[model samples]
Target: MEAALSRLEARVLVYVMEHVPAAVGGRAVEIALDPDGPPAVFASAPLAPSPGAAVVFTLGRSGRRVVATLTDADPVIVGALLARVERAAPAGDPVRILPLAEPALVDAGRAGVALLPPSAGRWFPDLPDAIRFDAALVQVSMAVFLSPQELADAQAHGPAALLGAFGRGERDLIRFGARPR
Candidate 1:
């Protein structure tokens, strides 16, 4: 679909590309997420590509976990992203890369494992279940996270109408790395 990489996330993806093996290919850098924005450097080589369509990388739980996913794109990117993610991640923080052929099977509230085919997007073990969205909304929510009121308005207005509201809110949180106080 559209270019989903933020400025900081794109920098991390580029770092992963630089360190990953040639076999990983250019597509190995899909979507990258970091709660703290771009880091000074990324550490790691590369890993095997995923077997799904698109791939996702999310940083959450106060940077305690890094979640990566493969869906609707080159599997190589997923592998490469995971490798760099693990290296760059802090000690004890979990990193998972799952393969999702359909991006519709992911559940709310899980950690340390990547979901595969039929799963929609990656999972951040630290996030609450109340925030998770279904397949359709997950895609949109990635770009933004909706407020409770906004979500209710969308729900009442139409099912698909507010689909992107939650995603937008989510994106804001991920991009900025936390909720405003």
Candidate 2:
């Protein structure tokens, strides 16, 4: 049944919609993962204030799903990042680093991707709703692409330290590839 198939994804989608009003009833674009594989449906919406700020997230993947807030919503780049997630994410591991060095990311100057647990009250505006989602035990992560040097820094100092650097600059988390200020 379609309901059964969407059980987990549906809940997460609901949480996204509730927090991201701009994404409510927004267009859902499906990017094919393979010639015969199920596509990843990205729920996308443009944020206000910043003309180019937008958020795109997957709603079809089971267990771990990826979300990113970027300067712009480029499907091609997002798709590439999602493909890397599919290939690199290890089972039972909450954190993942996906190596990516391509022309698409040249503008951002990021050579790798870090998938980290979304900070409470950062991605989800409603703490109560986020708490409820936590009860479900489904994991939704923020995808922040890092430069080679930054990736090495993370390796040396650890992901927590990297997150601390990002946290120091609140907006850095919302803007992918942004170096901590």
Candidate 3:
């Protein structure tokens, strides 16, 4: 809640949205799935589905599912972002929380940062060796909204670009089992 975010957190959220909307994506929409209804469909558009920003839609589940995309989505940032989103969020759209680094990583593909899915390998390898892994990587998807889109765009370039641009690393923790069953 805005009441919880520190001044800096609020400033950063506003600044990023105003300057670079990607930090929060253009829009954060929640989808209401109907079991017998047509499959939920998102635009098959570019990452920046909108003219100048990205759009992210999460499945509106029951529990308060916390999806932190950045290491900085720490308490302050989380409180601030949630407060801001609560403005438009409906009752069923689970309040995505900002969990600690480890849990965030573990929840990465499970709709943590994305409604689609993430490869399990992305989180498996070095995570068990938490210290070294955390020291090397800085998760920003949750913190800066556009960071995830940027990471996705980086694939066309190379891993070096991602590391250089974000000052972080995301090597495969292991080589297998990154998909859901």
Candidate 4:
């Protein structure tokens, strides 16, 4: 079965497909909806090696959260990018490790939590649209917004605003101590 992803999540997938800093072993924009462990970071060269660090993110009714993380990571890249984020944390803030229950979860073209696999089409959370956005997008949206038509508009608009959000989100990953390359 395919993963169940929200419309915005789908758009973000496409956005990552387009804007990943680099692609080595494929543009790794690995995302976990509700992850665990040290945040991971993934991007391409000059910024990092191909597939920097897989990114883990999540959305919830209370709020949104994101972190860049890695299973095994590069020291130089980790030092350069994650240092800033780590500094922001209180000493001993544990790295949240997303449980990828299945290795297949991040396999080439997957999305969502470890328990669920990737699926086709837009996905709505198990909630009403009134306050339906996941935590990450909720934070990104910064305000209440959207409808089916608006979602289509956002999707069809070619990820521009989302890209801007992605940029900011990447910075957030750095802040969250996403381990590097």
**lDDT (CA) for every model shown?**
0.31, 0.57, 0.27, 0.28
Off by over 4 Å in 3: 22-101, 107-181
How far out, in Å, is residue 132 in model 1? 28
Q: Pick the winner on lDDT between candidates 2 and 4.
A: 2
lDDT of 3 at 148: 44
Worst 10 residues of 3 by lDDT: 110-119
Residue range with the least summed lDDT across 10 consecutive positions in model 1: 135-144
Q: Summarize candidate 4's per-residue lDDT along 1-181 as a digit string, tens digits.
A: 1234456545443443333332333332222223454333323222334243432222221222222232223433332232223223212212211222222333312222111111110121121222223543422111111223333444457334433543354312122223345
lDDT of 3 by residue, 73-163 (tens): 2333233333233222323322122222233333442111211112122321221111112223211222223234444554445334433
Tens digits of per-residue lDDT, candidate 2, 40-64, equal: 5556666544455566666536345
- Using lDDT as the measure, the top candidate is 2
- RMSD list, candidates in order: 16.3, 4.7, 15.8, 16.9
Candidate 4 residues lying further than 4 Å off, grouped into runs, are 22-48, 51-62, 70-181
lDDT of 3 at 62: 21
Query: What is candidate 3's local distance difference test score?
Result: 0.27
Worst 10-residue lDDT window for candidate 2 reads 124-133
